[model samples]
Target chain A: MAAISLRRARTIIRKTLEKGQEMGLKPLSVIVLDEGGHVIAFERSDGASPGRFAIAQGKAYGAVMLGMAGTAQMQRAEAQAYFIAAAGAALGGQMVPVPGGILVRDAKGRVLGAVGVTGDTSDNDAAAGRAGIEALGLVAEV
Target chain B: MAAISLRRARTIIRKTLEKGQEMGLKPLSVIVLDEGGHVIAFERSDGASPGRFAIAQGKAYGAVMLGMAGTAQMQRAEAQAYFIAAAGAALGGQMVPVPGGILVRDAKGRVLGAVGVTGDTSDNDAAAGRAGIEALGLVAEV
Candidate 1:
């Protein structure tokens, strides 16, 4: 499995914050997780709440575990609320089906990991995550 | 600025268990977290309790966040229960004061990350953690 390099993960986070600044959005918490849904890098920008880190991490974990973009995963969670709830109980309470989660793919379309952003509107967060992936010259599975 | 490699984290977990076997301890759950206190790798050996992951993660997070080994942190928590409780409430209840967490350090003694082990006596767990770090030729700041 080709993992996301720490250098690349840092770049993704930096670009994500830059995008947020460009859009005049709130300070964001960004997390980059490995393909196994473990965090590789994380940053909570100034003015972002500490809670944002947990939310960002959960979003990234869910995105990678579900192998889908945040919006789609959230839609599924909404539609299958009971199932998601039950499944979350089994997964040690780490699932988050929010709009900030986006999958990162290499040039060959292989999933490398997922990046998630929080501390803004869900749509804006998702957009920032996608922007980060694009900024890395990688494909976004959003 | 060096990040804990996934391969090294895996090795830490494996060697930790090997130490457990040598010491005749029960199956264990181990977690490795980045300096940012985010889970970078984890494992639950066979026969380990299902809840070990959560416990392991909490110990690792507490150790890294406090910049002290789990045993010392747990001791401080015991002596200053009110402070730990107040802080935990402020941090969204993610704090755990246990004896299975240890910090990982580079050869230069810079804090790199933390390792947490569960499912054994706290002393044994801490010992296994130190062994794992030593096996990797890394400093265990316990």
Candidate 2:
């Protein structure tokens, strides 16, 4: 898989936060992780809760690590917390099954990384995450 | 700015442990995370309890995530435990809003990483974290 450039990661974060601000969301945290599940960039908007990044990282990590978007993983996790937790424990406790985590795919449909957003309602957060990926003309896995 | 070097991270860990030992504290574990809040290095002194690394990394991750020291995060977390817990639930349980987490900033004032020390008094742990950052002439964001 191709690597996601730091520039692209920064752009994703910048645009996501911008969208959050424009939407008048309370506050937001965003994180970008590479295909290998390593953090590429992270940011928490002013007034965001201290725990926002952890949640954001979890969402993104889950999306990448499970090869599925966090929105779906959240459903699975909710239904089977014990099983999910057991599986997530292996990933340095960074799995977050939530709606705000989305995968970023290149034109060739190869996943390059993931973007996670948190703060507002889950649906809004997911929208912002998807918007960020689309801003760069990249695909956000459905 | 370049990524934080593992050598520097190890130095921070060594100095942190030295401080813990000088205070005659219990076995300690330390974690160093890069700018992206990724663990760059970690160590658990002899006799340290299991799960020390998780606790140490959680503290550091909390500090970096909120752009505040874990000491302060712990304070806020106490007042809003419910909110923080709910938010943290998404991150696979890596958020620890407690003392002993300190930010590491380069001479340029850029966040380089964070140092988290665990297995000692909160105040003592925080002090050791600061000591480790100071040893490298790096600013520990108060």
Best by TM-score, which number? 1
Each candidate: chain B TM-score? 0.93, 0.91
Per-candidate RMSD, Å: 9.2, 8.5
lDDT of 2 by residue, B47-93 (tens): 98888988988888867765667766677567544334434555445
DockQ list for all candidates: 0.06, 0.17
TM-scores for every candidate against the unseen true structure: 0.56, 0.55
lDDT of 2 at B7: 86
Candidate 2 residue spans exceeding 4 A from truth: A1-142
Model 1 C-alpha lDDT per residue in residues B1-142, reported as the tens digit of each score: 3667766876788799889999999988787887888765566665565467667888888778878777787777889989877766765565667778889999887888899888899889989989998998999865
Superposition TM-score, candidate 2 onto the true structure? 0.55
Docking class of 1: incorrect
